[model samples]
Target: MAEEKNSIHEELIDETVATETVEGEAVEASEIEGEETISLEEQLKIAEAQTKELEAKLEEAENRYYRIQADYENSRRRARLDLEASEKYRAQSLISNLLPAMDNFERALQMEVDGEQAASILQGMEMVYRGLLEALKNEGAEQIEAVGKEFDPNFHQAVMQVDVEGFDSNHVVEEFQKGYILKDRVIRPAMVKVNQ
Candidate 1:
């Protein structure tokens, strides 16, 4: 009987120890789960902050790239304009130098021719002058009309004023030296007599 009782008591003590160990294990597992949840939340917050910072940096880089592209396009446009201007006025100096020679030719043609030979020579000179004028015209050189027109300081230079009965006041009476225009710009102004 004593032996049976002692076995029963030992069995109860074993059961109690097993229950306490199981409860301890359950509490430790719950604590570990709570820690994991807190760690996951912190990681998510850190990742969100990094994403926002990267997005901001990307936006700034894009803005800088667009500005550089716009600046390049403007510089290219300016260079093209400069090149066009230079090409348009390339022959200005040569045309200016030829003006005196053209004046001399005009003076030679104005002289009187008495004989048949003189007239023939004058006709040949006139033909040459006509050819020169045509060539200049083809190269975008144009003559400014002065006589019988309103006098304008932009195109006509008045060296003298005259009182002519037939002409109106402030009108050009005579052109002494011819003016020329190249393209849309005036190369030389006409020397003229203005009516008072």
Candidate 2:
């Protein structure tokens, strides 16, 4: 009966050892799975870092887009201003072409006359001269008067000089060709003789 009891005790000890071995194997497997989980976590962190980098690049791209848009808008504004300026100055060439006619009128008006028919022609020429002057004035044309004034190199060109008593030196004595201005800028300098 004692032998039977010892055999039963040994069987129970063997079964306990087998169960402990199985449990040890299961613990080792769990450790390997934990290592794999840690590697997966590292991969996820790398992906997150890449995503942040991409977001920063996108932000920079968006900033560049806004700058380009602003540049385009400024270019458009400048173009509009230039077009308006060109339109405003469109009549300058036409007015410049009519200056010779004005000179002819001045010469005709200065000619001597001795009859009623000549007087009538003179009156008609005066009317035409006044009309032409008015039209030029309306289009921003101005005349520079140099006679009896100080000779300024900016507005007057000295063609000849004469010694004159009782007149200030370097003063304009006669205007040869009248100077003209357009939009406050001198288009032609006055040709004049200066008193020496």
Top-scoring candidate (TM-score)? 1
Prediction 2 global C-alpha lDDT: 0.80
Residue lDDT tens for model 2, 1-196: 4565456556444433332235455433323434332343454465556666877999999999999999999999999999987776666788789888999999999999999999999999999999999998888888998999999999999999999877799999999999988776677889999999
**Model 1 Cα RMSD, 1 decimal:** 17.8
User: Model 1, residue 79: what's the lDDT?
Assistant: 100
Q: After TM-score superposition, what is the CA distance of residue 93 in candidate 1 from its true location, in Å?
A: 2.2
Writing each residue's lDDT as its tens digit, candidate 1 over 1-196 gives 4565456556444433332235455333323434332343454465556656877899999999999999999999999999998899777787888889888889999999899999999999999888888877877887899999999999999999999999999999999999998888889999999999
lDDT of 2 at 7: 62
Q: Global lDDT for candidate 1? A: 0.81
List the lowest-lDDT window of 10 residues for candidate 2. 28-37
If scored against the real structure, what TM-score would every candidate get? 0.66, 0.64
- Stretches off by above 4 angstroms in model 1 are 1-64
Which candidate's lDDT is highest? 1
For all candidates in order, the CA lDDT equals 0.81, 0.80
